[model samples]
Target chain A: MTPVARLSPDEERDLVVAAELGDHEARRRLVEACLPAIVALAGTFRRTSRIERRELVQEGIAGLLLATRRFDPSLGTPFWAYASYWVRKAMQELVADLARPVALSDRAVRVLATVRAARADHLRQHGAEPTTEELSRSTGLPQAQIERLQAAERTPHSLEERVDQDGVAVATVGERIADPQAEWAFDDVLDDIEVGEVRALTDLLDDRERLVIRQHFGLDEPAQTLRGIATGLGVTAERVRQIEAGALAKLRASLARPAVAVPNET
Target chain B: MEPQGTALRHDALVYDSGDEWVELGAAFLRRGLEAGEGGVVAHTRQGLSLMREALGADASEVRFVDVSAAYTRPVRTLASYHAVYAEQLRRTPSLRAVADVQFGPDPGEWDLWTGYEAAFNRSFSHLPAWVLCTYATGSLPEAVREGVWRTHPGVVSGGTWTRSALFEEPERLLRGSSAARRPMQVLRPLPVVDGVEQFRELLARELVAERMPSARVLDMLLATSEVFVNAEQHGGGVVSIRVGRADGRFACEIVDRGAGFDDPLAGYLAPRPGVGAGLWVARQLTWCIDFFTSADGFTARIVM
Candidate 1:
């Protein structure tokens, strides 16, 4: 393992000064020194098909580089702290760029227009959507072009509707409509447990105990079986079951020693 | 925040390096925050950490679930996501989630994950959300990447996405999945009712003996029966059924003498007053089901 170089605050400012003055070695060293922090800040963002963690690192380095160039030691803030926000924003900006939907070129749209006319003609004549081969034959374009047009003919789905969709069923249905089972299950689990008891149920338990109890009883997802919970937690199924038992024991013991009177005398 | 208003898009991104990995995750969370839709991220430990920091102050608004910490079984991951996502939807009207659960080192998991991706098209369809289901480019081999294009409607690359020209419906993708192919115990053609019953009995007996989960066996039985019903009703009464084990799942193909139905969404649309929901039901219950029709005849194939 290589020993990490630590720079004194003054040394860091000197490196920044050298980097800003177009000193290549200093720039490289500065970027290298901040690489881990840059990676961590960049790690704050994500990767898409166009870029990956490397790109975020690159983008972070870009931010760090820009910050290096822009930083004035007079500000007195450490370069690392100063660069962190920029490093984060750089990745976030890239993320914003990647989240966008694809736009078709005008030529493709024009080709699509001609293809649609042909498809409509084919449909009129044959009473069915034309296959890529058939559309190619009718439109005088290549089979690939026709297929591209066919794909483009469909409306471009905006991701914004991820939440705007009022008709959840219509949006979700590709083949079979999934059954709606959440609200009922949730209500069933916590419906009777008063707000006070909800906290009281877990007040004595640790985090793992709380999670295991909730998951074991299907308080979150469909009641995950012990094996299911085990898989998620990367533990043995037996371990998950044991944790659930211990948590239950604690809860039962707590409930048995009731300091508060029974609610509603149920 | 709010995605630039294109609608109903399914995009796939194949990233060459780690930097690209978080691209979709960032977009998903950022857009969710922009629109107040709420972001949910299910990813590996490394991925979750990156995303949480990326999310920053907005991170609290988002619900981040570590898939590595949670999902134990690949087959169960989709159902688990479904149940969990459905649970989240109850709290908010819409959501955008990045489900980056990791699988592999064992190529065998390829088929299971593929089936989950295909099943998810319908399972998560109505949730009023966009989910970017990611796979690393370096890890998943070419054979594994085979049906990846078909399951998704588009591909995201180079900071832009395009409609996947090769995108095939999930059913067809599953049917054509190279991973799903294996030596079949081909059975002779059988007539309706009596023959179908015999085939079911054999499948039930064999699947149980093979130590397949009993509930899964029953589910496959129901899906297979639906196809048989369709074959008998739509095509001529005679049909042949082939069963085999491929990629850790029981796969079966039913062939009928009818010309292929080209409408990929055929039985999936709303049921007519008289016509039954056979194919639709088959889709719901199976791990993966696809419809293929050619001159030889239409074949309804399923993997469970």
Candidate 2:
């Protein structure tokens, strides 16, 4: 590994001017001085992406060279600052091409935005988030398209942060009460088998998911707010809402139908 | 210091034949059951059947779980296994298990599986459990084969357990495995965001201009905001934020000039009170978040 050569700020600005005036040695020197920083930048990407560190370094150098020719000192930004963008951009372009599948077309992005705007409008009007069916109806998009848009945007949520609806994180009305003693009136005569079935269903969720659900419902402790759940889970209140939504969605889907259904309100 | 208990002893069992797998698995469990420790066997259907046959009446003493069913998602699997380990330990002083990991068919997915294998060491190292992960040597990719050697601390062969020289520390191995190595699309650059409001408005505008769908854009906004704010607070200061279209999805890399870290498990750990969960939130809201460190500083690349 080469010990990266450094230049004083004024000296670096001078080299940029000289290099732009077609000084080959000046340009070469500039690239050398920035090599270590570029390598270090590439190292950040090395652990997480599929692109090789060596290739990234080479790409960074290419960016630095381009910076030398195109940098305009009149803009008054540091040369390395301007050059580092090109370096990072170059590597990112390569990753975009080889690493990921076509993520979304400009058209797809537009369509999704349209659907989301419609959903937001519905939420504002109805004071609740809209379903895909409602969104499709209002947005004039096909249900399949809306569903696909939703599915494609499903991020890999950590157990503590599962976003379901348009980014709202959260729980039921009873769980929303600020006071622990303010118990809402509801039936508590569900059988042991029903309880066991719910347990089994909840078991399918990860630990944090289960924790969020339990905390929200006051299963073992007092019913808590989204903020309380977040603090307990060591996440943001917004993230807690998302996890609660996701968990409830999972539970609802599981409970909707089974050969032996739990008795509901008669 | 190590925890005061039967500390975890994780080993890899690389075998070629079905008979060898059953013989080794039954012997491993028998040795544990004889000492009154609980035994569990998580394997494919065939492996379970063979183990049951080999153990005869002893099979009734062991718990059998279909690996095909249990090993679906890496994080979920870890959580489920954690639950199982906790439950088993409550009934006995120690626990032993045969884990036949099913590394899926797609070669692209091997990294996560290998990561799971390596991560298991940190997640379960304190438990009083002995886990022998079996791998079919014939089917594994060369990279996966190397990963197996690197992730596990011990190797079990010919009914004997020996320390593996190839074993690397989990953090080091995961860092090496997590390095990005593929081609992605180009991202457009965003001007330096001066503050939180500016950052949000600029990033949202960029995504809107790119025609990113609203839900994903919302996610990207929340996720990227967290990364950018983190850079400002902890990363000395923000250098620049680069955003562009990659493979149809939007990508952003927030660069900062700070003394970068090398720990792979940084944000993955459960967050503590008063500690920031920004990285963890960013990780959850994107398709992937890859951390890069170089002499230049650090970059948190978020892809959605």
Best by TM-score: 2
lDDT tens digits, residue span B1-304, model 1: 4333322234566677657767566866787768767578887545665675456546667776755423323333554565556556556556777776354333444565565566567544534567776767776778656556767786675657777776667777645544322324543333333555455655665555555543355456666766776677777754566666543345777888877576544444222223344554555455456666644467777876
Which stretch of 10 consecutive residues in model 2 chain B shows the poorest summed lDDT? B268-277
Best by lDDT, which number?
Answer: 2
Error of 1 at B4 (Å): 9.4
* Model 1 lDDT tens row, A1-266: 11123777668777775554334566667766666666556546544434455446655666565555445454466677666655665676566544444466676677778987997899899998878888878777766446534543555433222422475534412122122121112222122322212133456789998777556543423446668888889999889877866764564343222211233654
Score every model by TM-score.
0.39, 0.45
State the C-alpha lDDT per candidate. 0.57, 0.64
TM-score of 1: 0.39
Clashing residue pair totals per candidate (backbone < 3 A): 38, 39
List candidate 2 segments past 4 Å from native: A1-266, B1-6, B30-38, B49-65, B69-80, B83-94, B104-116, B141-143, B171-185, B189-229, B237-239, B267-286, B294-297
Worst 10 residues of 1 chain A by lDDT: A174-183
